[model samples]
Target: MTDPVSEFSRPNVAAGPNPFSLSALPDNVAFVALFFQRDHYCTNCRSQVQDLADRIEEFHERDTEVVSIVPESVDHVEEWQSRYDLPYPLLADPDASVGDAYDQPVRFGILGALSDFFGRMPAVVIVDRRGDEPVIAATHRGRSTFDRPDINELIAELDELRSA
Candidate 1:
């Protein structure tokens, strides 16, 4: 099977030298917190990313990279980047291929597949890169639009990973 982390690559709209890929993170980066958004207009998604941005230093301190992926075109993600001025990588997954590869939740079957707004829920995947290849160390697949982990919960997960 193809490693999704290696396969996933996208243009970084926020604070990128260029494209961001899980397989090519900086050597110092031990983990990657991949945030999958429901859509471009979800206020909860926006707020979550902003919250991550605000506490980015915590991630950095643990040698983790915080990445937020939106299943929207580059233009939309660019607007978000411009508006939020996020400190970490803000990626645009126009086709949501990466989200699909990571098994991000999609409800309502056909309708959810047709419209991210209606079906897609939030998800967070933590990739541990300490091994020879990146591995999915943890995941939080939201059952509801609001069912997602808080910043502190994420930090705790990272701490647990580091200790392990």
Candidate 2:
């Protein structure tokens, strides 16, 4: 895989027509949008969506917006909403084309040189009006995820951004 920092932070990839810019959302707000790996689709992160819901106040304290981004137009809104108890928007990225624009898999696992191929990388992107680069949540190695986004860690990074 390409360096996460360079892939997401570089001026071109971050601001390109692809890779949904955080500022593109309403109010140029800072948003955390979710993306999953490959065809493993789930609107709500069943294991932790509820946990995210209960602890959403922590994100609210940081003035961060939380939105679940599903790859396909899965009509499981009510099911996921009820299951996760989420009070946030669940946006669809169609065929995950939007995510493809953001991540061009350069290499993956035994299957090296994957940029030629296409697949979704499990991640969360932090988009804001601060600059071109968006804060990368995690670029999991297939079927993996960086569970429990550390609020304090995120707060620190944003603070550094603001100061810089």
Candidate 3:
């Protein structure tokens, strides 16, 4: 299996641009926090996105770019962004191309398998982009509906990477 940090080779196509290549991000971007959501229909996912949206400035203060990726159409994602008043960028991966590249869990174990069959397992990936090197500093995966990465923890990771 490939280590999470080494997965920079994976393609990252964003909503606005032709593609938001991770490797191509400017050096000034200290880190990137990518939140992967199942879809706009998931209540838990919506809540999570809202929480991140509420703290968009906190992320920018740390020199990190925050983006949420949803496995839905561009129209749906744009609607969600407007509804939530999200300040960060939202990328549409209708085909889960980025999710597949990051190996997002499509099958949520044995019990939740049926419900999450088409769901992209929730995840938060923090990549340090200081200087010329972009390294994965942390990776969090939610196994259940209630599970999520702590925003405080993400902030701490950014702080730690900045000081390193």
In terms of lDDT, which candidate is strongest? 1
TM-score, model 1 to reference: 0.95
The residue-by-residue lDDT of candidate 1 on 1-164, one tens digit each, is: 21435367799988754688876677889988999999899999989989988899999999999999999999999989999999999999999999999999999999988999999999999988888778888899999999999899899989999998
Residue-level lDDT tens digits of model 3 in 1-164:
11345442222333323355576566667788888887778898888888887887898899888878887777877788678876666778777777767656665455544444454578877777664556667778777656787889888877887787
Top TM-score prediction, candidate number: 1
Candidates in order, TM-scores: namely: 0.95, 0.55, 0.80
Better of 1 and 2 by TM-score: 1
- State model 1's lDDT: 0.89
The 10-residue segment of model 3 with minimum total lDDT is: 8-17
Cα deviation of 112 in candidate 3 (Å)?
7.7
CA RMSD per model (angstroms): 2.1, 7.9, 3.7
